[model samples]
Target: MSTLIVPKLDEQPWPTLGPQIAAFIEERAIFGPGSLKGQPARLDADKKAALYRLYEVYPQGHPLQGRRRFKRGSISWRKGLAKTEFMAWVAFAELHPEGPVRCDGFDAHGRPVGRPVNDPYIPMLAVTAEQVEELAYGALSVMCAEGPDAEFFDVSLERIIRLDEYGRADGKAVPLSNNPGARDGARTTFQCFDEPHRLYLPRAKSAHETMVANLEKRVLEDPWGLYVGTAGELGQESIAEGIHEEALAIDRGEIDDPQLFHFHREAGGTYDMSQREQVIEAVREATGPVGEYGPGQFESIAKQWERPSADKAMLERLWLNRWVRSGQQAFDPNAWANNGLPGSIPDGALVTAGFDGARYRDSTAIVITEVSSGRQELWALWERPADVDEWELPLDELRESMAYLFEVMDVWRLYCDPFFLEETVAAWQGRWPKKVYEWRTNVASTVVHAVRAYREAIASGEVHWSQGDPQAADLARHIGAAGRRRTNFVDDDGQPMFMLQKIHPDRKFDAAMAGLLSWEARRDAISSGVTRSRSSKMLVF
Candidate 1:
């Protein structure tokens, strides 16, 4: 393997807490029940580097001294890399009397150490109770089973309590499921969110959001937490991906929140799985020391690849830790990623706007396309608030945004999907009779062609977008979440047609539909010879 492809750490001052933690792990912890069972838990170079970065404390004269540097962090690696084992060790360290202390200074060997907090409570949380039992509790239980560490800590299936008789410095580690009652009074000093990619489901998402919100309330008491997981399949909208995006934003200097430390180790990009050597190399890079701990990972991957009933996309996501689209995805996510540029349409440029509105369950979005350059922009998007039950669309705000778009840009055509916005569309059509049109997306014939044409534009690199726009990012997600659904009906030429449908019922695809409508309107305007300087007078109302 080439060392050039590996990630390099940035320069930082001295006094990192990694060495002390490493010493504790090597001395106290043992390998779980696997190929390396009973062996001392020792980290490799990559993992050790990640640990040092995660526990790095600012220098004494720095502005944020004496504070836990990273309030939230993540370790995204491939499967079978002992991610759960690492998390289990960290959980033990957190609950122990000497874990997670405020750094005072460095020792003779330049090892950072500090004083522990009083009354520490660390929780290992997961989306499902079964997963909590298997990944978090299972690993910790094995580590603290029959060793010197087991005598010092009372390890049980439910929780581990420190047996030390210290002065008001008691601590414990507990396994927590996705329940309001379990997370009710968790004033956590350190918390671990294991396998957060499973939170992509709706029910899991609800629990995960509530748990994270509750955890954030106690940040003042304990600002240190870890989000550890592998890369999820595309369109899942995993909370892990959300944190990963935030870390990328911070790294690019797009946002200024420095308390989030992200350590991601995956294959550089997509690999041609057809080539055996390429697949092996990618898997080897992703699974650092899995062979030493749990052999047969590569063999298992090869078996899965050769199996007739295996899902290739899912295997790529699980084994390679790459974000891959579903098998039925309507568009290639990589092609969409390539078309993102770093500019937006100039103000007052001729444009076509598309509006997609939903009432209670889904989202409402506006997508605008520049007539000349084929550049698409996400104008606005609104989703139902999680706290409300009977949430309604903010039509007034939508109307105001629409008016602002019309006033600022010379809109050639405004196509509105008249789903729950019949009245709004009618008003707009009356106001801008020459420009506004009620576009019905429910018609199979229109939708089939529109979806085909829009995807073709994206595939051909004709659709350009502003890079790093959060709304655009959301659009890409929604597009990825859409699956191609073929209909029984055929076109005039006897060719089968299809439409893009949501992969999951709760996941929204309104933004993608709005983009399609915008592209359709832009095409129509171009065919009708509509130019930027077309001086058509509107009647004053």
Candidate 2:
């Protein structure tokens, strides 16, 4: 409400079952896992409006008509809001026999109708066991154990089983602190996390992602996930923050993620926390009716801000719901996004190319840059398919792509990693001579300066790509995943040196590595006075 920093989805055109889902929640779920323990649940105006967007479905004539729009989403708000209680409402709807959650078909009026996910598997995950008991799992258990729907479910402290007609368990909502894969291969239809901001541990992250990977198994169920949390601590690289970055990219229009819905609301502008009125007003905007500033409310959350040891940054993150940047990221996602210059390098353009190859367990990529303008494009990338076990780089097709590039354009240089591409690089060098040179990243002694210069190029917009290009998303993802690694070394410029490495071990950045090498090749082309004319030779290794 306070000038929504990241706005919610539009309110009009209730072309979704979101409203129906909201109705189902208000009628079925209860108000408290906290203060109003046995009260009938009432979703406030703000909370009710969110369901409309979150439950949008694809319309007729669309590729997957009548299917729900979002496959995953995040809702970020200030502290003290009943986010876990809201998630519990959704969890009930996900598994309740009569709850309208999955899109069934169109109504006569052309709007989407909904049905419950069949045999739904819902996992409520948290960072620790105490947190598991303290959050959404707790809220859900209270709802099932104490609410009107209590007879429909067999509830326990850790699990809720929806009873079938014969009084047997038909669906389950389980609480897990580790990977759900270990349980029953994780057929996660609709999973919820209380606060991914606190889930920075490697084990928790890995576990949650396993459930995500398992979402595809129940494709007919229209599987999805809802993560509700606030801003994360800086430098932690929390899951919420990662999704927050993805949300920002979606907002910027630099990338498209059609199946993701992220709602981030925070009060805008700075405030003097010492001014009681100003602080209360900001809190009021963030909390709305839940602000508790009125008389007889008894419990005031604002006292925490006045504590002597209160950290202003922590206060801004938790209370104001502001995003804080991490220092470990090698490139700023915003800057990289802004550099979407819009157009691919044309045929017959003078170019410098970089090739980074891996035989297996990673991606092999080639990126090319137009020398005259520094515009870059992903030429090709070979990645291992998950379903394929006996996979390797398609050398035959790779050679065809390489040969065709030289056939169509004036390639100034190809700085290639000769690791798995040793035979290919040798053949390329034999044919192109001075045009091909080996760039081994592991030899940090020489390539560190080149790496530093390429980083500078991206920062200053010396290199850019078209947002409209099909490869922009891949490039953006690789760029975002890249992190600065300490080299315990220095470059020729007498500054500390670093290398770009994957922030998550599970993520790959071969395309970004190829782009860096491409820019470095262009730098040396300029230094050696290489021209577009074929009469001159490039820098030889």
Candidate 3:
């Protein structure tokens, strides 16, 4: 009989560090800290059951360990697993000494491989949910091991999953919910926040507070470290942006490093319109070999996911280390330059005032208007500088101007279209005795009315401006360029109310504010209020 030859276990070829990390395992996958040998595993039946209820699967990993790890061992692969199964595996992996590895995703063909490989693979271990479970498992895993010193506790946000949940985790989350308002149960040694830039303006405060709390709690154990998200809005208070700036300062030798890990999206240059074409061309060149659609295709592949335009811009900044502008105009400045009117009003014409209040660096201007020969004439303008107190402006000048118009022109009532300006209106009333005043509470609604009035007046040939007053013409152009559209807003009843929302936050013409004020001051006539005793002494006037 021929002797059966079995290769010695020690006779196996030892792969180099690169290939060993990149080695394909047909069934069991080894990741991170490498081979799982004698790592203590604590199978918690209660925590396992709770996770089972959440994910709907058995809590314990099958055969515990060393029954060669399965090909689907990494966090991402298990995430793609049945939810309950994935949860059970994450719970088990968290408590197990080796911190989660994957067997799927081929080195070249994208085929399933059992052993971990290291060919520029995406780090799936840092997935938000997986990180949370990993955090929860850390202490337990350490406890189950011989002593605390044997296991390292990673409190990084990359390992904490609970922050992503909305509301307290009473296991009420619907499957696949992406709620940001959820409570975090991940308590570990230290924590690192991920993607803070994705947070909305409204949620910024609460999210920041949570990070601070976690940092404080962990600091008691050691000089605990907290790493916030690294890419986001340009605001001073933006969490990601703030952290990234700090990291950049460290890199530039402007600051000392506390040994913090910074994964920054470098914005190499200013994001101006001038650089837009260059960016596009760069993307094209980078993807030229693939085809016209190659740029987008390459980016999608690089990101390993489909992303929205806003997110795409952010990702490009982060990973490719590219610079990109936010790329939308607040208002079109050209619209003002092309459409503005060009001088002083003719004598003995009807007049009105356009006044706007100042709040910031933007100055407020008041324009005097008159109607003459089928045209509106701008006679004069009074402007408030940004540096001075708006309330301290010369009221006597305004009064004198109105009084002069009343004497020389067919002056209309000086309209004060807003009732909310009680102080300003009262002041004006004190200055111009017997002058007319009009007011409305809802400025937005009144704006709608004024827009309609302007449309009608223009159609009827009742609107005109001075031929030489470029500022007045520019103001007109700004007003004319203001577009209108319905937008969804929440009413008092918590129901959706469709109203006219401004298209441009930066570029809106305060036409409504101006028109309402003008209309209130300059309307033609008013009928008296109804009264039964019309001939009484008080009513006879």
Ranking by lDDT: 2, 1, 3
Ranking by TM-score: 1, 2, 3
Candidate 2 clash figure, as a count = 0
- Strongest candidate by TM-score: 1
Error at 428, model 1, angstroms: 6.1
Q: Which ten residues in a row have the lowest lDDT in candidate 1?
A: 1-10
What would the per-residue lDDT of candidate 3 be over residues 295-389, giving only the tens digit for each residue?
36433434332333446555554433332323221223233233334445655555565555333322233444442233443333443332244
Global lDDT scores for all candidate models: 0.73, 0.77, 0.34
Tens-place lDDT per residue, model 1, 331-350, is 77778878988878878788
Please provide, for model 2 over 310-329, each residue's C-alpha lDDT reduced to its tens digit, 9 standing for 90 to 100: 77667767877766534556
Question: How far out, in Å, is residue 49 in model 2?
Answer: 6.6
Q: Report the number of clashing residue pairs per model.
A: 0, 0, 33
- TM-score of model 1 vs. true structure: 0.72
